[model samples]
Target: MSDEPAGLVRPDRRRPEPLWHQAEMALRDLIDQGEWAPGLQIPNEDRLCEMLGISRITLRHALRNLEEAGMLRREHGRGTFVRSATMVAGVRGLTSFTDEMQTLAVSPGTRLLLAQVISATREIAEALEIAEGDSVVQLRRLRLGNGQPIGIQTTHLPSARVPGLFEAASDVTSLYRWLKDNAGIVPVKAKEVYRVGAVAAGDASDLELPVGTPAFEVERITFDQRSPFEFAVSTMRADRYEIRSTLYV
Candidate 1:
């Protein structure tokens, strides 16, 4: 579950200690206890100041400390939000993009941005377990929902397996689902790693950000009965999305 902090408090003038520090401790407690879970947005600055009865500097000091500790993250002009240390439930389950969009009540669409075949570089070879100079199919697409560019997905499939997949999958909906329905490849288990980083220069323009704006990174490797079919890297806008995970005791 996501945490929504509504306990912004500006203290009365009669209080001996400052309100910001007090509010900071309260927020820290909230985070530690899973009250304000990671990737959830906290109240904005003005609301926080008014609720906590503290100056901007004091509130910022507490916030900066928490952010540095990896419990939170801040963005310019967007707002402050929780940063999950690990992938949540939604991210863990292996599912198609089509299914995810349906769950979120958004219309999913893809623009076939690029389709190319190139020799595998050392990095790609290592990741895909193919020899260097072996050809691979690289598909680049802009993933959209509700007519907004939410993310970019670049998938690399070994040419050995899917020689003509790039051309055949010209912006077709839901590669995973399509594969399962047509080619009889269904993923059983997949590994996904999440990281916080800036968008790359090449993708900056496509992502509609300055040269190096913050974004959510997901690098994943998926396997089907046939082979490791999907290795992709995704970047999402930090402001528009949040993280959720279930922790078992």
Candidate 2:
């Protein structure tokens, strides 16, 4: 996990902006700057209220925003603590966890949640530029920042390119990063489809989403010039999340 503080570029209590949201962003910046490292319990609500010059309700709103973003977790009596930063490196850039997280100034790291060899189904084979039933390496990841869950990414790659990827699946934080380091398959272009949906039961169960909440879904097909590299499915929390892109149209 490697990310610097998210500085408050915009004040929330401005003319049209919301105070609580602005305060939340400012606090997030403080946490990202290493002012509050992960696992280190945050100051009590009363202390936070004094520091931010906000009421308890306002402070709580900001805190709740962080909790939903998966950047902070609140335990019964333990208090709020830092969560890992997740990347939203949009279709505008060709990047991996290591690249994007570093840009955001966060310590981006990965933990392999699953690695397996499976016969490529029609959908996957089509996406990966391989024939049906071809061998594919399924790599699943739980991306962390400092130490909290920020995203869940799963990839399917042709085994030929990443031989025994399943065997290499120990904490490969960035598959694209892995590609550059291991195969030199630097991506130049990628096609992405963005959608919004509720966190599935299984996803919610794993990510600890608050019973019912929406998560953004990003499906991507990475390419290196003429060939496809892999197929990916990623789910990220909507709060504190966005795909900033430039549009010419």
Collision count for each candidate, in order:
11, 13
Residue by residue across 1-249, what tens digits does model 2's lDDT show? 133224434343444767787778778887767777767777788877666667889889989767755567788867778764544444446777667766665577687778899999999999998999999898888766556576778888888888645777894666776777887788898898989877777677557687458888889999887588789998877753566554886
TM of each candidate vs. truth: 0.62, 0.64
**Model 1 reaches what TM-score against the true structure?**
0.62
What's every prediction's RMSD, in angstroms?
11.5, 10.1
Q: Which stretches of candidate 1 lie over 4 Å from their true place?
A: 1-91
Candidate 2 vs. true structure, TM-score: 0.64
Leading candidate by lDDT: 2
